[model samples]
Every structure is written in C-alpha cells, then in structure tokens.
Target: MLLLALLEAAGIAKLGASIGAGIAAIGAGLGIGRIGSSAMEAIARQPESTGDIRTNMIIAAGFVEGVALFAVIVCLLCLFL
Candidate 1:
C-alpha cells in the first residue's frame, strides 16, 4: 500500500511536468506562426521593398526562435529541478 501511494504521487508529479512542457511549446508555436504569417503578407504586398522586408523578417524570426528556445530551456529546467 505504501509503495502504491508513492508511485501515484510520482505519477502526478510527472503529469505536471509534461503539461508544463506542452504549454510552453503551444505558446511558442502560436507566437512564431504569427510572426511568420505577418512577414509573408508584408513581403507579398510590397515586392519592391523586399530587401527591407526580408531583413526585418529575419530579425523577427530570430527573436521568435530565441523566445521559444528560452521557453524550452525553462521547461527542461523545471523537469530536472
């Protein structure tokens, strides 16, 4: 009975960690997708200004990727810590 109780508690802890990781990914996906779509639309509307648009898009994409990486790192820390 004691062993079963311990296992149940561990299972609950793991579930929380799993949920945290999943939420982080979802948030990152939404943010990155929004940045990408906006960049694409801007480029489509102004082909002549493609150079400037592409530069900004690359910068924005990098920011998005950085944030996502940070979230993932935090998630991993939470799981391990």
Candidate 2:
C-alpha cells in the first residue's frame, strides 16, 4: 500500500509539470506568431520601415521568449522537487 501511494504521488507530480510546460508554450506561440506576422506585414507595406519594425519585433519576441523560459524553469523545478 505504501509503495502504491508513492507511485501515485509521483505520477501526479509529473502530470502537473507536463501540464505547466504545455500551458506556457501556448502563450509563447501566440505572442511570437503575432509579432512575426505583424512584422512581415509592416515590411511588406512599407519596406522603409523594416528596420524599426524588426527592432520592435525582436524586443517583443525577447519578452515572450523570457516568459516561456520562465515557465520551462518552473516545470523543471516542479519535476525535480
């Protein structure tokens, strides 16, 4: 019985981590995708604005990437803890 309880607890912990990682990816994907598409459109419409558009896009992408990275770290900690 004790072994079964231990196994169940481990399974729950793993499941929670997996879910956290998956949820984090969703926000990252949406944010990056939006920035990419908008940047492309901006460049297409005004080629001269490419430089500015790209700069802003990079900054926004970095922020999104950071959040995703944080989520990944949290997931890792949850699993190991």
Candidate 3:
C-alpha cells in the first residue's frame, strides 16, 4: 500500500518493470534455497547418493536462475524501451 501510494505520487511509469524484476529475483532466490535444502536432506538420508543429489540440485538451480535472468532481462527491456 505504501509503495503503491509512493509510486502513484511520484508518477513513475516503469513501476511494473521494476516490480517484475524484483519479484523474479526474489522468487529465484527462494526456489534455489528450497532446492538446496531438499538436496541436503536427501543426501543426509542417503550418503551414497550424494553425487547424484548434488548434480541434480545444480541442474535445477541452473534452470531456476536462467528463467529468472530471462525475466529480469525482459523487465529491463520494458523499462528502457
């Protein structure tokens, strides 16, 4: 509410882009944290599968990061163009 009021008062036209980038970054961070936490739990349960768990975690993290990066880039484009 406060943010909306501020933006409205400031008459910022690119607020949507800024908000989109922020949401994407925040979502990616949360997603990566959850993936890491789960992988750690799995590894703790099965030490023998540590390698597989770590590999899968990295792959999943990479995908999340890639999507976040794309979102941020699109948001930036919207802001600039």
Candidate 4:
C-alpha cells in the first residue's frame, strides 16, 4: 500500500511540473508578443527613434524570457526532487 501511494505521488508531481512549465512558456510568449507589438507601433509613430525603441524592446523581451526560463527550471526541479 505504501509503495502504491509513493508511485501515485510521483506521478502527480510530474504532471504538475509539466503543467507549470507549459504555463510559463505560454506566459513568456504572450509577454514577448506584446512587447514586439508595442515597439513596432512606437517605431512607426517616430521613425527617427527606431534604434532606441528596438533596443529597449529587445531588453524587455530578454528579461521576460529569462524569468520564464527560471520558472521552467524550478518546475523541472520539482519533478526530479
């Protein structure tokens, strides 16, 4: 009985980790999409500041991706430990 319970708990942990990783990926995608859209709009409105806008957009997107990566790693850790 105890062994069965342990297996069930491990399964549940793996499932939760997978779900969490998926959610993190989705969130990062949405965030980067929004940043890109906004940056394009800003560049269109002020063509002369294109360089600045692009740089800022890339920085923001990088930050979002980093955070998402961290979240995924944490979730994966949950599955293993």
Q: Which is the leading candidate under lDDT?
A: 4
Backbone clash pairs for candidate 2 read none
Candidate 2 wrong stretches, greater than 4 Å: 1-10
Tens digit per residue, CA lDDT, model 3, 1-81? 778567656757388889999999999999999999999999999999999999999999999999999999998886775
Give me the overall lDDT of model 1: 0.75
Q: What is the TM-score of each candidate against the true structure?
A: 0.70, 0.79, 0.85, 0.87
Q: Candidate 4 — which residues are off by over 4 angstroms?
A: 1-10
Measured by C-alpha RMSD in angstroms, how accurate is candidate 3? 5.4
Cα lDDT of candidate 2 equals 0.89
Candidate 1 residue pairs in clash (backbone atoms < 3 Å): none
Which tens-of-lDDT digit does each residue in 1-81 have in candidate 1? 776457556776456666777877787778878877887898899889888987887797788778877877776765665
The residue-by-residue lDDT of candidate 4 on 8-73, one tens digit each, is: 576976887899999999999999999999999999999999999999999999999999999999
Q: In candidate 3, what residue range of length 10 has the lowest lDDT sum?
A: 4-13
Task: Give the best candidate by TM-score.
Answer: 4
For all predictions, the C-alpha RMSD in Å is 5.0, 4.3, 5.4, 3.6
Show how many residue pairs clash in every candidate, following the order shown.
0, 0, 0, 0
**lDDT for each candidate structure:** 0.75, 0.89, 0.91, 0.92
Q: After superposition, how far is residue 43 of candidate 4 from its true place, in Å?
A: 0.5
Model 3 collision count: 0
